[model samples]
Target: MSEFGRENPQFYLTAPTACPYLPGKYERKVFTHLVGEKASALNDILTQGGFRRSQNIAYRPACEACKACVSVRVRVDEFQPSRTFRRIIKRNADLIGEELPPQPSADQYALFRDYLDMRHAEGGMAEMTVLDYAMMVEDTHVETRVIEYRRRGPDSGIRGRGRGPLIAVALTDVLSDGLSMVYSFFDPDMADRSLGTFMILDHIERARKAGLPYVYLGYWVKGSPKMGYKIRFAPQEHLTGTGWLRVEGEDDAQD
Candidate 1:
């Protein structure tokens, strides 16, 4: 093959695995590697086409006779926070998000461990060691960032950065069109503050300021409680056969 032909990504299909979100269902994926000098541009195209990034791979669900996983993106310009979402934002107002390089830290790992232990004890990532967490943070060829949420320090306003203990972290990919949240974790102790929802809200604001029109939120699986909060971010669009269809409210969202 020519250099150009060799550089083209070859897709692969994964063996079926038990679905993490849905009970008694198997999930399979069709994936491709996101590497080489073209990775960033390729990431943008793949993300827009409903594939999600994991390390150096881009994948989307390809299970036969099942389509529960629906890719969704928030419409930045049209988004209006609901009363509960507004409360989540206010509850987290004391926190400030600092965008940093995709480098892992001991503090982040500690919080990640705590989150998994408390919230996802039986989940697939429960056994992930520090090294695995590090790879999750750093193993990427795409344009990526690690956002650390921490309590505002005395000089935060002057420095434009937060200080003190880390409360949450989001692994995000900066795409040509929007910010794609690859993965995220938070301190389980702060669950009442709804840190997950807060992060998405924060990303929406960040995208708005940067003139980006969407915040890609991966998949929103119907009937999965774990995926329900996603649909609450109204004025969002769901990837469908006819392209992205706008869903204005929770009731409007469909499988």
Candidate 2:
């Protein structure tokens, strides 16, 4: 029996596969299902232990010989944006992000599809159907929200939401200690806006506004070019064998 009044979570190791982040390396994962009444609580615990949630599953790197996937979380209250990050925010000023319930829509799927085609056509999620996209958003038992970014309309300030076509979307989870960015995608045409980085900056601000201490940014591989952007946020903490340790670097200036 386990703490949730059932058998203990049965963990499984995934078969080794080509590492997505590094060339000539393989990767594996330890995963378990997040289900039932205790799913939310279990998710929080697993996440704190460095696991990332995808739909109804929580998984973490269990690679045989590689430890490149280090978990990272931004110190929301202590974060200071770089000049480059500030520029990204300024460039996206016309967009507004509205946090809505985890309900999928045709419009969102369209944007998701376009993003996949343009950015991740060779990735795993590129083949996902509309149904799969909806399941990703609505399958969770934990507290989750979808933040949709769009162009601000005339009534935006009054309603606190934007109108026009959806340009980006972020699937997030509200953990007891932080906000976990489950997944996010944007219109590839708007790459110049740096919407990806802007979304993270916004999430940090959102976490600060909600009195959260951290904003989980999932894994950051040290040598992976694709993951280098995560390190730009200052005063972040990286999970280590001992515990979560604050990373000190050139970007440590206080805001």
- lDDT (10s digit) by residue, model 2, range 13-43: 9999999999999999999988777788999
Worst 10 residues of 2 by lDDT: 246-255
What local distance difference test score does each model get?
0.90, 0.90
Residue-wise lDDT of candidate 1 within 1-255, one digit each (tens)?
Answer: 346633898899999999999989999999988888888998999898999999999999999979999999999999998777788788888999989999999999999999999999999999999999999999999889999999998988887689888899999999989999999999999778889888999999999999999999999988898887788888999999889999865833321
- The per-residue C-alpha lDDT of model 2 at residue 125 equals 91
User: How many angstroms is residue 166 displaced in model 2 relative to the true structure, after the best TM-score fit?
Assistant: 0.3
Model 1, position 220, has a per-residue lDDT of 92
Judge candidate 1 at residue 101 and give its lDDT: 95
lDDT over C-alpha atoms for residue 136 of model 1: 93
Q: For model 2, name the residue pairs that clash.
A: none
Candidate 2, residue 227: Cα displacement in angstroms equals: 0.9
